[model samples]
Target chain A: MTSSTTLRQESVRETRAPVEVRGLHRAYGARQVIRGLDLRVQAGEFLCLLGPSGCGKTTLLRTLAGLDAADAGEVDVPTQVAIVFQEPRLLPWKRVDFNVRFGVAGTRGARAQALAALEEVGLADHADAWPGTLSGGQAQRVALARALVREPHLLLLDEPFAALDALTRIRMQALVRELVDRHRPATVLVTHDVEEAILLGDRVLVMAEGRIVRDSDTTGITRDAADAVALDVLRRDLLRELGVGG
Target chain B: MPFLLLLAWQLLASGGAIDERLFSSPAHTAHALWMLTTNGTLASNVLVSLRRSAIGLLLGVSTAVALATVSGLWRLGEELVDSTIQMVRTVPVFALTSVFVVWFGLGELSKELLIAMACFFPVYLNVHGGIRNVDRRLVEMAVAMGKGRRQIIRHVVLPGAMPQTLVGLRYSLSISVLALVVAETLNTTSGLGYLMANAQQYLDTDVIFACVVVYCLMGITADLVVRVLEWRTLAWRTGVGNR
Candidate 1:
């Protein structure tokens, strides 16, 4: 079993390619959300876009997912891309299995693939449940499973666990880490939580006023201990930038 | 409170607090009901009215849904039909009844047509509004997931709009019943409206009251049916029963 799992992991690691973005600019009306932001994610890297509220982290993620058009700059992305929004955004009319399979080609194999994704998220038993019945954490997990099922070249997340309770958020962070390790998709997660960013991301990019302010690596540090260090640094830097504290 | 008022009305009539000739007692109306049932006239008239109303409601709902969907989804189609419908809907049901009677004659056809016309606007507007107001975020999610237009409509638009559509359907059903009664009163040979009209001509207040009672019962029955349908269709909606 160990040998087979190792082979599977190696095969997954081989499939991904680095994603590159250059001078990305997004504006909504008169408000400029992202101003000429440049970023890159190496193949199989977990990158987090960490920022304060209204800092355009979500806008960046949406642009990457191809859901929102960038006002300026070019983003060269792989065709295989999936996104998990902050809200579960699951179809209420569809059962859990159908919601996960939604956007996938409609076939028997697609249903099987959805089931496998649910199992990976530890939600195989909820395959027949409705989206409305799910707790916030469960729903977010389902959304994650939905993104994972696509086997995306780039998995973009827009604060997918922001609504969960503290305990559930920690569990979900760990679950995401495990899933990323297994799937090895080059991922970009936008978040307001500094600790979450440090815990889940191989590389963290801090944004302020729609531009990258800091970039750092937290490869070996676990999220729990790394939280305090990352939060203290990020708070001081963000406060200084906002002119809240000198 | 309504029940107590009704009871007071019964007491006032029984005690001759009001003239019996002008307002027949509830007991007299109940007796009239028995008489109509015994003669089978009430049942027959009710069946005719119900049949016409049901057929007209079915036709109106289906046509409105089809038209509203087409217009809602397609810009050109909406522009083509929107002004026409808005203009037609402004003309009262009574005004159209005469025209329908002229075209289809004073038969079931004319009455059914009038009811269908009466039922159309409420449903059309509700369905159109529902489709138009669907959350753009959900649509964005579906599109990002690679859903085609048809799939989005079926899986996203339809489900999201169902609650509003059902609301429109319930309103339309009540209007259809009202239109059927009014059309029958205007130019129908058979129906509860005919019975009431005939009773009124002879000043048989009891039979008139009985017919009115039947109309109320039918309206209540139609509402109950719609509620059942709403419950079935919107099983996924939270706090549905409370609403």
Candidate 2:
């Protein structure tokens, strides 16, 4: 699995790359959602996209996931991609373990892999539980486990933890960070939470009116004592850019 | 509750206010049921009736599923099948009995075809609606996870639509048994419906009551079968009464 991952990354970088959107444009009949956007995410990069409602971050993510066609320009992503939506989006009839194995191909050692993924999300004990029985936080964790189990070259998350309680949201953000770090997929998380962006991303891109307006490096901005003020300043600047408190 | 109804029926019969020709008492009905069972013809007739219903139901359910899947998946297929089916379904099923008899003769074919027609629409409508109602976000999620078209249908769409499909099947099961009654009564020489029809001619209230009991048992059995299937297949439903 590790070898294939590196090999795919090498081939991807040699040609179209894992996730490279350049001069992208998308429109919904009368209204445009993305316009000539250019962004490149390296393999193993955790990039958080932050924007107000209607800023096209979700549209960009959907385009990358291949759920929608790009009206123009390039969206070069690996064909094997996984997505975790705002809802768990589970097949309710299936058990919890099967839901976590949603993107996986077959049952050859799949149960163990699904269990391992569930273990990563701290829900291994609930692997047999139904999705309907899960709390929102647990369901979102299963969604995360599902996205990671396929060893996807790219993982797209669209506000996956936004519906959870505040404490659950914090724990989920940390869980996502850990999973992304361990699995090392090219991750793109779209969320409106500025602090979540700072806490979880290697870099943060602020989008507005279908274009990226702020590209801030969030690496070492949270844990490093020296960068405490820098982190605070970046947070305030992002909030200001988003028309939040000055 | 059933025992109380039986006791009330016994009391009514003993009171002698109601005529026996109109209805048989519980003891009389039970005695007639025993006689029919001991005579050895009732078992074969019940088997024949059940077989016809099962075959007709199978054929109907298979066709309904195929057409429903086609219409549910593609816009062109829907345009071709959905509206046409909707129009045909509105025509009362029994109204086609004469036309079916003229076309296929009074053999088992006509009866089975009629039963199939009767069973078809309910299953088709419910399964089609179920497929169309499968969560759009779930399909989106599956597509985003890189599942191909066949994989999406097999793994996602089919299971997602199964609850509604089962409801359709449950309804069809009931109609199948009762359709057997209609079909058997029309031109059959055997089966419980034949016995009932023959008893109607002679005013054999006890025998008619026995046949009615068999029909009720068949209906109840069909329902219990569906309940068992639902229990096994739909264990995931949280609020389901059974599990």
Candidate 3:
């Protein structure tokens, strides 16, 4: 029994990185969307992908989430994965709790589990409310809760906070950071906002024309906006990579 | 406003400005309605007509929903079925009465089939359009969550198409009633149309008007039933006075 337990622990540790990709290519008819990309996300690491609108960030995210197939090359992801898109994408016909319960099995205590998820998002009082009736921030929170309830090995976020106002976006970013730390998923967040990438990521990758051009580690940098020197230097470097004037 | 219109109609008929033989006053029509009710003809005819409409609507709407679902979910099904429906819809269904009578021998089958034909197209067209118009992003989200095809259809596609399907039901219900009126005119031994046709031999315009009133009531009542159903099933929808 002791030997078996040791073996299981070793296997679990070996599978720490939930995503691995090499030479991944995707295209739409004549136009290529993602071309010859390679990435790996270690367990409990938060990696942010910063890119312009047509720079294949969303395409890469979709391929990672298994929502789209790659045209060529090898891509491996864990079986359990969740994604939160820019839109909340809740079913308008379902109540808040039911939408959260969507991916959950209908076995015993499913409702309780759903309610617990809602509680984590500060929406315990709105479990029975229609999704259409909730404010945009609350709706996005429910979406986050929906993704988190699955306890996924990997979590993919496609600019989820883009539609939110600045104040709400900050709060949601905090919530995501807190949740990712607690749940310990290998997370990949695709965003156009360089500051968001800096604040939320352990590592940031800047992409241009469907290829990663720069990779930076922010492990020693403080995320606080008041840390003007470090934040400014990081922002200037990212802007230079993106070919944007600082 | 209705009462004022009735008063005006009555005054004009009694004053001889309009020929009473040609156009019955509201009072005359009310008298005819009372006589039909007292003699139990209205009750029996209404029951017969209701039964026919119910059975025909059941057949038509169920078949339409089934076909729409099949076509909406699969490209092959759409390619196989949609063009035929479009072609058949272009031909007026009401004008098929003679062909139906010749095929079915003027029995209740002919009338019921006519009603079903009238109800089928609008329901199928709207439901097909609705299912096709469901947001692709939502479908992708469901797929990402590992939802199976059947689960996605049941949970996402059907409910997404519901609002438009209800609109189709409202339209088809009115069309069904209109088709019923036309079908009941053909060798109907026991319906409002038969009663009106029998009275026409005697030039009884009042009974004709009474039948018109019953048809109006049926249309209004069907619309109200659909409205109530929409209110109950689409409770999550907020716009259009739901708030």
Q: DockQ of each candidate's interface versus the true one?
A: 0.36, 0.60, 0.55
Candidate 3, residues A95-126, lDDT tens digits: the string is: 88889998575523678888888888899999
Residue range with the least summed lDDT across 10 consecutive positions in model 3 chain A: A1-10
What fraction of the reference structure's interface contacts does model 2 contain? 0.71
Query: Which portions of model 3 miss their true places by more than 4 Å?
Result: A1-16, A223-227, B239-243
DockQ of candidate 2?
A: 0.60
**All-Cα superposition RMSD per candidate:** 6.6, 4.4, 5.0
| lDDT, model 1, position A228 | 67
* Tens digits of lDDT, candidate 1, B1-243: 988988998999999897877787888999999999999998999999999998898888889999999888889979998778988888787777778888998778888888888888889989988998888888999888878899899989988888899899889988887897788887667889999999989888888999889998988888898899888888777532333
Ranking by TM-score: 3, 2, 1
Candidates' C-alpha lDDT: 0.83, 0.85, 0.87
Whole-model lDDT, candidate 3?
0.87
Q: What is the interface RMSD of each candidate, in Å?
A: 3.0, 2.4, 2.1
- Once fitted onto the true fold, the runs of candidate 1 whose alpha carbons sit more than 4 angstroms away are A1-14, A23-37, A52-55, A71-73, A107-111, A208-213, A220-246, B1-18, B238-243
lDDT for A126 in candidate 3 is: 93
Docking class of 2: medium
- The runs of at least 3 residues in candidate 2 whose Cα sits more than 4 Å from the true structure, single-residue gaps closed, are A1-18, B238-243
With a 3 Å backbone cut-off (N, CA, C), the pairs that clash in candidate 1 are none
Return the candidate ranking by DockQ, descending: 2, 3, 1
Interface RMSD for model 2 amounts to 2.4
